[model samples]
Target chain A: MKTVAGIDIGNSTTEVCIGAFDDRGKLNFLSSASTRTTGTKGTPDNVRGIRTALEAAVQKTGTPRVYPEILLLNEAAPVIGDTAMETITETIIMESSMIGHNPSTPAGVGQAVGEIIGIEHLSQAIQGRDYIVTVPERISYEAAAELLNAVQGMVSVTGAILQRDEAVLVYNRLRRKIPILDEVAKLSQIPEHKQAAVEVALPGQTIHMLSNPYGIATLLNLDAEETRQVMPIAKSLIGKRSAVVIKTPGGNVRENVLPAGEIYISGDSEQTVSIDAGAESIMAAVHEAGTVRDIAGQENSNVGHMLRRIKGGMKNVSGQAESSIRITDILAVDTLAPVQISGALAGETCMEKAVGVAAMVKTSQLPMREIADRLQAELGIEVRVAGVEAVMASMGAMTTPGTKLPLAILDMGGGSTDAALVTEEGRVAVTHQAGAGELVTMLIQTELGLHSRITAERIKRYPLAKVESLFHIRLESGEIRFFEEPLSPRFFGSVVLLEPEEMVRIEEDLTLEQIVDVRRGAKKKVFITNALRALEIVAPEHNLRRVPNVVLVGGSAEDFEIPEMLLEELANYRVLCGRGNIRRTEGPRNAVATGLVMSWWSE
Target chain B: MQTNKPAVHLYTVDETLPAIREICAGMEEEGVPWKILRMDGTARGLAYRAATDSVLESGIGLTAGEVALQMRKVAEDRPLFVFADPTAEQYRMIGANAARAVKKKRFVTVQAG
Candidate 1:
C-alpha cells in the first residue's frame, strides 16, 4: 500500500489524516488525529504543532514500513490580516445675532421682538410692547437671552426660538414662567400682518401649524398666494417645538442677503473677527467667542467644549517655548448665528488619534514573510502561505471524488471565513473576511460571562442531556461500557439520574440552547453578513443566482449543527451545502494535506 | 515497425517560444505523440492553443495520464503549464501525469530557458 499524509494547520488546532492507496489505486482511510496549534496558526511558527500532529497520526497508523513510498509533508496557507480605516470630519460654521435677510420683498425686514427672560432687550418699553419675533434654528435659547440682555433694556423675556432640548432647561432657569415656544422652525423670516404663534414641538412630534397648511394659514392670516408661498415653511416645522409669527400690513415679504467673503486661517487666534464691520456682525463675532470662552471657563462643559479643550491643552508639549500660532481653517456660514471653527496643528499631535486607530486596523504582511523564513530554518521544509480561499478550493476539488469539474469551497475558520470559486474556464476567485468562529465564541463568552474559552467552546460544540437517573454509559466501537459509576458532586440536583453508575447532566445554569441562539445570532450578524458581502464583492459581474454548488470544510464543519445552519441560511439561493467527504474516504481534516500532495500534479 | 535506439535529451532557450519550438522538434524526432495545453493567455498563444486542441483530439480519449504525456512533451519547451484546476472538468486527465513528472523531477525546468 502507498501511504499519503494530509495536514491542516488551523488557528486553534492542527489536524492530520493518513491514507493508504492499495495496488488497485483505491484510497482507504488509515488514521486521523488533531493537536492544539501552538504560536500563531497562520504563521510559519506553527510548524512545531504541525510536526507534532503528523507524528501522532503516523504513530496511530503504523505505516513506517511504507514510509519510503509514502509522502510526508504539510500544506502551508499563510494567514495575512487585511484591515480598512476611514475618518470622517464634518464642520458647520454659524453666524450669531445677525439676521439672514432675504429682501426680495420688504414686509419681512423687521426684527422679531419677544419678552426677555434672563436678559432685557434694547427696545424695551414700560408696558413691554415688543414685537414677538421668531428665533432662527441656529441660535440657542440661552444665547438668545444673552443677546437680548446685552442689548441693555428692561425687556421682559417671555419665549425664544431655540434649536435643541436645552430650550426647556433655559426656560426653567428663568425668574418668571413665560409662554415658551420650543421649535420655531422659521424664526428668522416672519410674514407681515400675520398673527402667528410660536410653539415648541415635543421630541418626535411636528408642530401642528407647520404640518398642516390650514393651521399655518389660520395662524399667519395668509391669503391663497401668501399661504402657498409659506407652505415650505410649514413643512419645515414638521419636527420643531417653538415658532413665532407677527401681524404685519401689506403681507409677508422674503429678503436675500449676499454673504461676504469667508476668512480662512491655519493658526490659533484669541477672538472671533469679521471682514465687514457692522453691529450685527460684531455682535455675532463676540457671541461666538464669548460662548466658547464661557464654556471653557466653566467647571464642567459639554462634549464639544471638552473636545476643544483637549485639543487646545496639547499646544505646548515638553515645555518647549511657545511659538506663533494661527487658526487652521475658518468656514463661513450664511446664518445669523456665530460661526464654528475647528483647529489642527502642524505636527503628529493633530492626527495622532486617527493614525493610532488606522495602525491598529492595518495589520502588515511583513510578519508573515518572517514567519515563513523562521519555519523553513527550524524545520527542513518549504512553507508558502496563501489566502485561505485558495487553499479551500484546492482541498475541495481533491476531496470530492469522481466529481470532475469546477467546484467552489468555503472554509470557515476561527478568525476568518474564506471562499473560493473555480470556474469551468479554469479561472479562480477568492475572498476572505475577518469575523467567523472567534466572533461566535466571543458572543457565547459575553452572553454567558464564561471566563474560560475552553468552557465556551464546549458549550458551543456539544448538546446537553439531563440525567434523570444514574445509569451506565456504553460505547459500541470501544466496548468500554461502565455501570454503577459514581456521579460527581457537581451533578447532583440539576442532572437527571440515568443509571446507578452513570449520570446524564443537563446544563440548566448554562445550556446549549442559549449558546446556539447567541452563536447563530452572531453568525448571522458576522459570518452570514460577511459571506454575502464577500460573495457580492468577489462575483461583482457574475450573477450569483446562477453560481454552482459549494463545498464546506474545516473544523467549523465538524460541528453537527453547523451544516444544517448553513444549509438553511443558503436555502434561498437553492445552493447545495454539505460536509466535505474527505473524512469518510480519507479521514476528516486531511483535505488540505491531500490537496497539497495533489498540487504537485498542477505545478 | 522497426525503431532506432532511444536516447535522453535536454534543450534550453532564452525565450519561451524558441524553447517550446526546440522541445516540439525534439518530441517529433523522437516520434512521441504528445500534446500541449495552455491555461489562460500566458505563454506563446498560437503554439499552446494548437498543441492543446491537437492533443484533445489525438484519439487518445481525454484521460489525465494522456494529457500529462502531452504536457510533458510540451514542457520540454514551455516550462509553465496548468494541469490541475479544480473548476475544470478535464483537470483530472492532465493532472495525474503532471503530478508524476513533478515528483520524478522530469517536469519542465521553470528557470531554465
Candidate 2:
C-alpha cells in the first residue's frame, strides 16, 4: 500500500489532498483541507499555509502529520508580477452644485417657478410676489395649510417645500394647486429667497425640466455661456423620480478630467503608452512590446504610486528588495470604476472608463526549493516538485467520471490561467497566461468602484438587485421581487448583492443594471479573453479548433456562470467546455492536488 | 430648448385632481406642457366623456376610492385607465408604467376570454 499527499499552492489559497492506495490500485480518498495562502503564490511563505492545510487533512483522518510516504507539490510558475499592476484611474468631483437626490414623494403636479422663502414671513410677503414656502418639520400639515391659505391673496404661494413627508397631505389642502416638494432631509441647507423650480413627477414618470440642461437654462433665463455651466447639474438629475432646482447665486458646476500618467513597457524594444489613451490603446501598446520584460509607470503618477505599493507589498511578503522586482506580464482591462465626486453635494458619481492592470512579477526560484526543504524536514518524507501545474491539473481532471486522454484542461487560478493538453499517447503541452480570477475581481472592484475586495468577490459570485422600495427589489433581469418585511434602510434604493445568506448593500452610485453589467463585463474580459488566449498557446499548431474538449479546473470553475459563458464562447470551434468533477466527487477543486497523487498510479 | 408639447394632457375630477396636480407639477417644471380638464357630473360619466372627447385619445382617471368598477364601465378601445389611491407616488409610477407599457406594446390590457 502507498499513501501520498498532494499540495496545491494557489494565489489566494493552499489546498491538500491525501489518499491511500492498495496494491491492486484501489484508492481510498482520505480527507482534504484548505486554508488562505500565507503570502504570495509560488513563494516559500506558502509552506506555512500548506503545513496548516496538511495538518488539518491529517487531523480529519485521525493520523499523524507525517503519515504520508511522499509529498508532491505543484511545479508552480515562478511569475510574481501578477500583483504588480495598479489601476491609475481616479474619480474626481470638481463641483458641488448638482442636487441629484430623489425624494420618494414630491407633492402637486405642475412645475412651480418662484423664489424660495421661509414660511414665517408669509404675511409680510408682497401680494403678487411668487414664492416657494419652506415648511420645517415642526409645523403640522393642517397648520401649514391654514397659514398658506390665510395669505393666499396676500402672497402668491407658487410652490411648497417641506422637511416632512407631508407632500400628499399638504397638496390636498392647498388653496392654489402649486407644485410641492417635501421630505428634504437637509432642509436647512436649501438656500432661502433663491429662484427655484420644484418638480414632482407623476406616477411612473421622471423629472424632465431639471434633468435637461436646456430646461434649466430656460427656467433660470441663462444665456448660452451660463447654460453650459448648469449642464452637469441637469445631467446629474436625469432619471430621478423628483427633484428641486434652487438657483444659488454663486453655485457653479465643473467636471474635472484628471490626468493619469503613462505606462512604460520594457521588453525587446522599449515603448511607452499613455494611460490617458484609455484601456484599449494601453493594451495595444503592451501587446506590441512582444515579450514584456518589465513595466513601470511615469514618476509621480497614479500608476506609479500603484506600482510602488505593489512592489512594497511584495518586498514585505517575500523579504526581497523592491527595486529587484521585475513585472513580467501585464493584463490590462478597460473597466468603469466609481469615483466619488470630490465636491458632489449629494454623493453622486459618474461612471469613468479606466484601465485595470494586473501585472505578473518574476521572482527567484529559491522560494519553492526552500518550501520543499522545510516540508521534507518537518514531515520526514520525500518532498518533490511535480510537473507543470496545468499538466498536473489535466491529470487530476482526468479522474472525473467521464474524462479521457487527449483532453485539454484550463486551470483558472486566482493569479494566472494555465492550460494543458494530454495527447492519446500521454504527451503533454502546457502554457501559462497572466490574468485569471483575481483580475476579474480587480476589474469588478475598479469598475464598480467598490472599496472592498470582499464586496467585489461577492459581486463576482452572486447576482445583483436594486431595492427600489421598502418591501420590494428589482433584480438585474428586470424582475421585481417582494420581501416579507421591509428591507434595511441602508439597502433601500441602492444596488445590492443578493447573497445566499443575506443581501449585501453596495454604496456605489450604480443602478442594478449598471452593477450587473460591470460584474459580467469583468468576468468576460478576464476569463473569456484569457481562456481563448491560453487555449491557442497550448493547442496543437496553436490552433484552438484542434482541441475538441476542454475541462475547466480550479476555484474559478465554481463560479455560477463562468462555465456556461465559456461554453458559449468556445462553441464556434465545436469545443465541449465543462467543469472538472474530480473523482466524481470534488467539483472543479483539488484537481491539481488530486492529480499529483494519481501520477504515481501510472508509475 | 425644445418647445414641443406633450402628446397627451391630463383630465381628472375634484377628488383625483390633487394627485394629478402632483403629477403635473413635475411635468410643467420640465416643460412638459399639459392641461387639466374638469368634469361636471358623476365620476364615471366624467371619465367616460373625457376618454371619448380627449384629442390625445388617452386619459388617466384618478380616484381616491374604488377604481376597478368605474374603469370596467369605460370602453375598452379607448386608452384610458383608472388610478386608485392617486397620491403623488402613484401618479409618478403610473406615468412610468404607462410609458413602459407603451414601449412594450401591452398598455392597460385586461385579461379575459
True contacts kept of each: 0.00, 0.00
TM-score leader:
2
Chain A superposition TM-score, candidate 1: 0.45
| TM-score of each prediction | 0.39, 0.73
- Residue A286 of model 1 has an lDDT of 33
Docking class of 2: incorrect
- Residue lDDT tens for model 1, A1-603: 656655566667776656676676666666777888877544545668867876777678764532313333443333322111111122211111111111111111112344322222234333444434344555544565456454424554344434332343344444544444433233333332233344444443444654566666675566887677555344433443334443334333222222222221122234534323332453254334521212111223222232233223222211222131112111111112111112110000111000000000012122344555665576555555433436544553456653434666667666566677776776778765545665565545544545676655665665443322123222212233333643332342232213335444434243334545655665555556545544554452755555566667766766656767777777777766666776446423456766644443333
What lDDT tens digits, residue by residue, belong to model 2 across residues A377-402? 87678998876677778888988877
